[model samples]
Target: MTNDFRILLKEDMRNDETGERWFQDIEIGSVFFFSVQASTLHDSTPPALLDDVMAYEAFQVTLQIRHGVYNFGKRGAWQHLEDKPWWPLFEAESPVLTVAANLPVATVQQVYEDLVACEKAHPEMTTKKCLRSLSVC
Candidate 1:
């Protein structure tokens, strides 16, 4: 199975109290959501079942910039700063970022840079540690 991902929606949310948007200002607690469309192709499937073999799915990814790390909402995972390979998912030319062109590229780059700095300062934090500290685990 070959899968391709594309951004179906990109939302840069603002702070409810501060009314500050993420793209305009890189805030520590900024949040964003990306609705992705995944297309999977099954090449081994019979020609008669080609249409059924190709499947599409829509999923949402929620990310929040914490004090010194970013959190993946669904998996409750904390991503560190050194992870740059996945950044391509936000770039315009990447397969995963084909849609949502309304978002400025520079703004996305700035967010990435800000996240790197935020995570670099506190590399010890992880999803388990964070949840344990909050007594949520």
Candidate 2:
């Protein structure tokens, strides 16, 4: 790998599910930071501190995304994204996404116009871009 990969997207493990909580589709040269943490409850009562406990902290600094799968060890934990392509690494179902801030509002109208033109030029492409709230690529 030539040391260039940027994080296209990432999600933290906010709920219980095994494995690391990071994903990316970066260019050939980029740098990013991922702050990872793990915790467990102790004693099931007040004063949640105890000696028999496990704790982990790390800065997954500067991951380089080459064209193949790479697995870094996390205390023998199983990674959900193992052996999967970048897109499939995303959960099977789409998350309930809030409107992304960077998608320029005006671009929607422009894209619609382009789609219309494309359909006119090639009648086979006349499918609707919006079908049941999912954008058709």
Candidate 3:
């Protein structure tokens, strides 16, 4: 009864000539290691506080613990006003993969902590995984 997955990070850059957004860069941010089940994808996984696609889910698995490999960096103070948003990394964009998303990206650690205390706790997860932290020691 294992059906938990990790969230990957995507980077977007706007073209200087065309001013088009692209989702050219996708990096593995943090990952929660759980046994994959066939029903994980089709079944209702944990609801995303943020708008992210569902990777896996299970009735017994509530997202709590996570292991991060790379940092998504701190949240920027960019607002969607008439002002310009601070986006520097562009030339490295894949053009084919990059796209625009102004919403603040949640850190892996933050997401983990949130799910642990989520009101809609999974039946099995609420009793186990949700109580743990990112560390093993």
Q: Highest TM-score, which number?
A: 1
- Give the lowest summed-lDDT range of ten residues in model 1: 41-50
Q: Which runs in model 1 stand beyond 4 Å of their true positions? A: 1-101, 127-137
Question: What are the RMSD figures for all models against the true structure?
Answer: 15.1, 18.6, 18.7
Clash pairs for candidate 3: 22-98, 22-99, 23-97, 23-98, 23-99, 24-97, 24-98
lDDT of 1 at 4: 23
Give all TM-scores, in the order shown. Answer: 0.24, 0.19, 0.16
lDDT (10s digit) by residue, model 3, range 1-137? 11122333232443444423222222111232211111222122342222333442321222212322111222111111113232231121231221222212232223234322332332232223323543431
Query: For residues 1-137, what per-residue lDDT tens digits would candidate 1 score against the true structure?
Result: 11122221223443445322222222232222233211121111121111221232222222343432234443222343225554444434331122322223343434444544554455444454543454332
| lDDT of candidate model 2 versus the reference | 0.23
- Native-to-model Cα distance after best TM-score fit, residue 43 in candidate 3, in Å: 29
Candidate 2 stretches with Cα past 4 Å from truth are 1-101, 126-137
Instruction: Judging by lDDT against the true structure, name the best candidate.
Output: 1
lDDT of each: 0.31, 0.23, 0.25
Point out the worst 10-residue segment of candidate 2 by lDDT. Answer: 94-103
112: Cα error in model 1, Å: 0.6
Mind giving the per-residue lDDT tens digits that candidate 2 earns over 1-137? Answer: 11111222244332334322333322221111122112222112221222221222112222222212122333111132223232222222212111111112233223223323332343221123322222222
